[model samples]
Target: MSTTNKLLAGAAILVAAYAGSSWYVGKKAEAEINHQVNEINAAIATQLALSLGEGEIKLNVVDYDRGWFSSKVNYEIRIKSAKDEQFQFLAQDHLRHGPFPFAAIAKGHIAPLLAYSDAKLLPTKETQPLFDAAKGEEPLRAHSFISFGGATKTVIDLAAIDYRDEDGNQVLMAKSEGQVDYVRKGGKEQADFTMTFPSLSLVVDEGDLHVQLNGMRANGSITEQDKAQASEGELHIDQLGINVENSTQIFIENIKTASSYEVKDGLLDSTLTYDFGKILADKQDLGQMQLDVGVKRLDYVMLNQLSQVDDLDSMDEDELLPMIKQILVNKPEVYINNFMLSNPAGSSTLTSDVRFATTALDPVENEELDLGHYVESLNADIRLSRQMIKGYFSGENMISSMADMFFNSAAEEAQEAGLVEYDGNEAKLALSFDAATNKLLLNNKPISVEELVQILFSMQMGGGLF
Candidate 1:
C-alpha cells in the first residue's frame, strides 16, 4: 500500500476506537444513575412499610426509560388495611432526572443537580368527586435539588385542596408553595423547611350557618438543629379575616400572628405576638388588641417527647398516668420572661420563673409523686392596669354583673387599706413561695392556703380569671 492509503486506514481505526469508548462510558453512567434511583425507591418502600405498622403496602414500578444522559421513572404506592377490601391510600409519581456526567461518577462525587417530579394522589371511587375537584385545580409538581453533597432540597407547588357535599361545602384555595431541605451531619439528620400560602381562603357553607375565612397569607420555616433534642422555628401570617352568619353573627378582621422558638441543651426560648387589628361584633368596632409573650428555660424537648407518645391512641388511662408522671418529673425549669396584653382598654404584664425540685422522683421505684410539693419553689411578678379590669367588666354580660358585685364587696376594704388606686390605673404585685414555712406570699405578705383558695375562688367566680 502507498503512504497515503496507510495513513487513511490508521485514521479510521482511531475514530472507531474513540466511538466505542464513548458508548461504553455512556452505558456505565446510565447504570450507576439507575442503581442510585432504585436504592432510593427501595428505601422509600421500606419506610412506608414500617409506617404502616399493621397495614399492608404495595409499591409498583410502572416504567423506567434510560437515555444516554437522562432517565425517567414512574411508580405507584398503595396501602390497605389487612381486613379491608380496597386500598386506603394511593399515589402515583413520575420522575425525570439528569445529565449524568461520567466524570463526576468516576471522581466519586455528584455536584449540584435537580430532578423534576410530579405526583397524583388517587382517591377511592367513593371519594372520586373530592379528588376530581383537587385535580381540577392543578397537578402537584415537585422539584428536587442537591447541592455539593450537603442537602437534598425539595420544592412543591399546589393550587388548592377542596371538597364539596350536600351537608357542607368546604374549600381551601391557595397558591401553596413549599421547600424542604434535609441534611445530615455527624450521624444526625436535620430538616429546615418553609411553606407559603400566598392567597389562602377557606369557606364553609351549610344550611343556616355560613363561615368564611379570607385574605389569609402565611409563611413559616422550621429548623431542627437536632431532631431528637432541639429545634427553632417561626411562622408569620399577613392577615386573616373571618365572618360567620348564623344564630349569632361574628366578624373578625385583620388577624395577624408571629411566633418563634429555639431549643438547645435542655433549655427552650420562645416568643409570640398576636394582633387583632380590629374586631366587630354586630357591626360594632371593638378596637385593636395585641398580645406578646416571651419564655425561656422551658423543657421543650421533654414536652415534645411527652407529646409524642408511641401508640398514644391505643393507650388507656391505666397505661398513661404513669407516663405523664415520669414526664413531669423529668421536665426542666421554665421561665416566663415577659407576658403582656394590650387592647383598647389597657395592658397587663406578668413574669414568672418556675422549676420542679425533683427530690421525690424515682422512675424505677414507681413511687407516686405529688406535683404540688414542687410548686412552692416558683417565683412570680405581676402588674395590671385598673383600666384593664374596668374595660373587661364594663360590658353588659353576666361576667360584668358578677364583677360589679364582687368589687362592691371589696370597695370598703380597698379604700381603708389604700391598696387599690385608680389614679394611675396600675397595680404591681410580687409572689414567692417559701419552702421552709410552706407558705405562698403575695406582695411580701404570707397568705394561708385557705386564704389563697378563697382569693382564687373569688377571682374565678367573679369572672376575673382572665
Candidate 2:
C-alpha cells in the first residue's frame, strides 16, 4: 500500500476505537443514572406511605440526554392522596449534572448540579368547590434552583414561592435561599444549614387582611442520630419581622431565639433563650421581652415518641392522655433559669428549679384523672420578683385594684406565717409538696394549688373572683 493510504487507514481505525469506547461509557452512565433515580423514587414513596398512610408517589424520567462528560435529565413527580386520588401534588425538574464520575457511579454515589424545580398543589374534586369559593387557582407554583458540592455533599438551594388566584391576583409570595451541609462521622450523620428569606407576604380576605415580613434568617447544626438512638442540635435565629394590618394594627421586630438540645442514656437536656426586640400595637412602642429555659434528665423516649406523631389532629385525646401519664411517670427534671416580660413601663423575672417523680396514679372513674398522688413526689423552689408585682400595680385601674384585693385577703396571713419575705423590690417564696399531709406548701405554710390558681384567676377577672 502507498504510504499516504497506510497513514489514513491507521487514523480511521483509531477514530473508530475512540467512538466505540465513548458509546460504551455513555450507555453505562445512562443505566447508572436510571438506577439512582429509581432508588430515590422508592425512598420518596416510602416516606409518603408513612406520612399519608396509604398515599402513592410516582416519578417518571421523560427526557434524558447523555454526553461523554455531562448529562441532563427532565423528570416529573406526582403525588396523590390516599383518601382522594384526585387530590394531587406535582413537580417538574430539569437537572444538568457535571461529569458522570464513573468510579463514584460504580460505588452507587450520584451528585447533583445546578437544577431547576417547580411544584404545584392542586385541589381534588371533593375540595375544588371550596377552592373556587376562595378564589384559588390550580397552578400555584413554587420554583427553586438547587446546586450541590462538597467533599461530604452539600446543597445550596434558592427558591421562589408564589400562589395566585384565577384572575392572576397574587395571594402569597416568598423567596428563600439556603445552604445545607451533610457529613457522616463515626457511623452517624451530621448536618448544618443556614437560610434567609428576604421577603414574605400574604394577602387574604380580598386584600382586607395582609401580613408581610421584611426579613428572616436562621442557622442550625445537628447530629441526625447518636449511639443512644437520639439526636441533638443547636439553632439560632437572627431575626423575624412581621407586620399585620386589619381590624387592628400590629408589628413585631427582631424576634431572636437560640436553642440547643442533647440526648444520651435515656436522658434529654435542652435550653432555649429568646428575645423579642420590640413590638408595636396601633403604632405604640412596646419594649422587648426575654426568656431562658432549661430542662434536664427529660425522658428521651417520651419526647421522641411524641415527636413521631405524623398527624396530631387525627389523634384521639382518650388515647393521648394515657400516654402522657405514662410519660410523666418516667420522671423528668425541669429548671427555669429566667423568664422576664419587659417594656418601657416595667419589667419582672421569675426563676424556678423543680424535679418530678411519680409512684402511683390516682384512680379515675370516667372523670378527670386525679394527679394529686403524683404531686407527692414533686419538689420545687420558685421565686418571683416583687418588682414585677409592683410594676403591674404601678399602673392604674385594673392591676392596682387586683393587687389591693390580693393583699387585703392574704398579706397578713402570709406575714404572720413567715411565708412572705421582702427585700427592696424582690420577693422570695419557697414551694414544696408534702406526701403525708397531701398538701402543697408556700414557704412552709400549707397552701392548696387550687387556691393559688383561684387567686390568679380572680386577678384577671376584672379584679374579682368568679
- State, as a TM-score between 0 and 1, how close model 2 is to the true structure: 0.58
Q: Identify the runs in model 1 with alpha carbons over 4 angstroms from their true place.
A: 1-89, 100-116, 120-127, 135-139, 148-150, 160-162, 182-190, 214-229, 246-277, 287-321, 334-339, 359-372, 382-384, 389-429, 434-439, 448-466
Which ranges of candidate 2 are over 4 A from the true structure?
1-162, 166-174, 229-247, 259-273, 294-326, 360-428, 433-441, 444-466
lDDT of 2 by residue, 324-441 (tens): 6665675666777777776665565667765554644435555533335555444544444444444444545687667755644454444434555544444456666656566677
Clash pairs, candidate 2, are none
Instruction: Give candidate 1's TM-score.
Output: 0.62
Best by TM-score: 1
Q: For candidate 1, what is the lDDT?
A: 0.54
Q: Report the C-alpha displacement of residue 98, candidate 2, in angstroms.
A: 7.0
For 1-466, candidate 1 gives per-residue lDDT tens digits of 9999999999999766655544454454344435444544443333332233344455655555644334455555555544444554444444333333343344354652333334555555644665576767543556554433335667777657666667676565656787877665675555566777655544566535455555555545444444433334455544445555555555666777776665566555666676676666655445556666565554554445443444456768776665545545544456666676555677777788775654434343434333346553678887776555555655556875676455444543342343332234455657777555676776678776566566656655655532
Candidate 2, which ten residues in sequence have the lowest lDDT sum?
143-152
